[model samples]
Target: MTARGYPKSYALRRGVILRAAVHTTMLASEPALGGFLAWDGTDYVLNNADGTYAAITFDGSDIVGVFFDAESSYNPYVSGGAYDIEIFFRGMPPRLRSLAERHALAYNRQNYQCRSMALITAAFWSVDDYLTAAFPWEDVFRHGAHIVRVELLGDTDEAWQEWREAYQCSPGQLAAARALFWRDLSK
Candidate 1:
């Protein structure tokens, strides 16, 4: 069972289905779903261990969002490291998540684009919920923000944050981490 009391099999099935959907969406070659680095006629593709990829979406030259593809995400800190893998399976560290987020914010800021960042993922991975809920979702949806309001997350950011925080043993998230890190992963 998951921390939310979902059966492990159910979660795994949902993950597989969601991954297929994401792959299909990417293959459709929709301009809105194109990789962020498309300006140079190339993409900043983040490859996963399973040979799948997560690409950033852009509106014109401004990056708007990214989907967390199945499998562990590649370490963006390592240049020319698309194949590099995260140590943990099924999810990534929250700190790394934060780092990538900061980099994205900086990138957008430097480029004078919207500072908004969307983390779109099917919340089937072990720590996906914990990571995605760390930030508040924007209520007023931007041009490319529609996909961020996917199924797993709650209708409102506050509601999602409450669920995730309680599940992660929060009040003090770091303290909870020290006491209960990966404790419910077997669920």
Candidate 2:
């Protein structure tokens, strides 16, 4: 079940351009890389919907995650750099990652899950007037946001499949999901 292996150890070196701990102040100056997901200890660090880092507790159902290190400072991979990228593989709350693994590409959770919610909203477009009120996304979204444990929802394939059917994801969405599916965090 170990998707990828991590470095036995990572030692900080001089002037390492990217991949520093999250606390590095220089991260602000570095060009924005796409969101970074990793471990800052036992907890998991995820890019929140609002452009902030979120730390989620782990459960068995979470998708595989990674932690990269050894850089003198934290620099997101998107910041132009020549250094080799190494990752320490693990997991946390795999909410989005889980969807990606399921090939639900267009289901972005960014910006308060707007993209996902939009898909659900679109599903309503196809709903009959009588069943329109039966759209269940609100319950799903609410449970995801309010529940302290991801296990209550966003924890199984069945839940995601329902959303996938409701949204009627496009080919682009499938591609996106496949692209984001798994983290190859091996050294």
Candidate 3:
């Protein structure tokens, strides 16, 4: 049985299936269902030992939101060091279900891009790092700021303060870092 805070009634009506993100990952034991991931009972950390798991969040015939996590998420960008993934659009009408699902998938694509910096060249740590690296992601971050409302952040703010307090800035280094840090990242 799917646990509480989970969907108990879902029969794949109209090819729309809602996946739940249960910490226990008991959903994996069910037949034909794909793998999954869930929080560790001890902490919010996604436990590797127990394998991927999640529980459905509805019961009976009610059509609630689908609860899901990295394992069940079709987004390829998710499993890549994205520790924080919370996409919720509840209380929407059933007619908009398709649109809601699509938005949920894309709600955090920019977030994934932000986290991907950690995996890229070791030189890129924060805005300071990007400045030091000749300001990569210039176009993406710039477009993000200039066009849409996107918050590009990492350790840049804190690093800026630290740099202000700890050491004097060279004109070139400061300018380069500042340009990428202040301008390119945020509009």
Candidate 4:
């Protein structure tokens, strides 16, 4: 197992962030949002551009094993319909894991996955509320890092149609789409 306790093959290196666009069909508008995308412990966060968040776990990079916050209703309606999500693994110390474990123990007693979207949404909203209540938006903005916006285009066939239509791409350009997911550097 790796230091984070994931199987050797499943472990992702520290400081490497993988960003992906997820076209959410589950939403009424099928909104596309960026996923800050990290694999920590058994969970991953799909941090939406509007400050909303989703938590999930994978059996492998391609197969989602569980969706922690699957039923959340809070969506941050950011401008341009684009969202930025950041996963800050560098700052999460061991104490945070201890706190999370304690949270998990109490949480599991309720017969729900702590990683679920519903729970994560509550956490996100709680944090946002606390920030807003304690400080001005400018103060919060100044303290927070400037998140880079990235397009999280969905890989689904239907999502592809929407993306193609929006980008006005020709067949040739469409052919290059597969290249986007391939990590040439891994070679």
lDDT of 4: 0.30
Off by over 4 Å in 4: 1-44, 60-119, 122-156, 165-173, 179-187
Question: Model 1, stretches more than 4 Å misplaced?
Answer: 1-22, 25-94, 101-110, 113-145, 151-187
* Residue lDDT tens for model 4, 1-187: 2223211212221111222321222222333322344435655454434443434332223211111222223122212232212222223344433444343222212223343222221221112112111223232222221121122222335545665574455675555543443442254
How well does candidate 3 match the true structure in TM-score terms? 0.18
Q: Among all windows of ten consecutive residues in candidate 2, which has the lowest summed lDDT?
A: 8-17
lDDT of 1: 0.31
Prediction 4 TM-score vs. true: 0.27
The runs of at least 3 residues in candidate 2 whose Cα sits more than 4 Å from the true structure, single-residue gaps closed, are 1-33, 36-42, 51-53, 57-151, 154-158, 161-187
Q: What shift in Å separates residue 93 of candidate 2 from its native position after superposition? A: 22
Model number with the top TM-score:
4
lDDT tens per residue, model 1, 1-187: 3344422333332332333233333434344434332222221333333423333322222222243432323223223343312222124345544443543322322111233433333221223322222222221122122332332332234533543442342345433432332232333
TM-scores of all models? 0.24, 0.21, 0.18, 0.27
- What lDDT tens digits, residue by residue, belong to model 3 across residues 1-187? 1231111122221111111111122233343223223222211111122222111111223222222223333233444444332223222344334432332222222334545311111011111111111223332223121111111122334534444342344455445545544342253
Pairs clashing within candidate 2: 19-75, 20-73, 20-74, 65-90, 105-177
Question: What number of clashing residue pairs does each candidate have, in the order they appear?
Answer: 1, 5, 18, 11
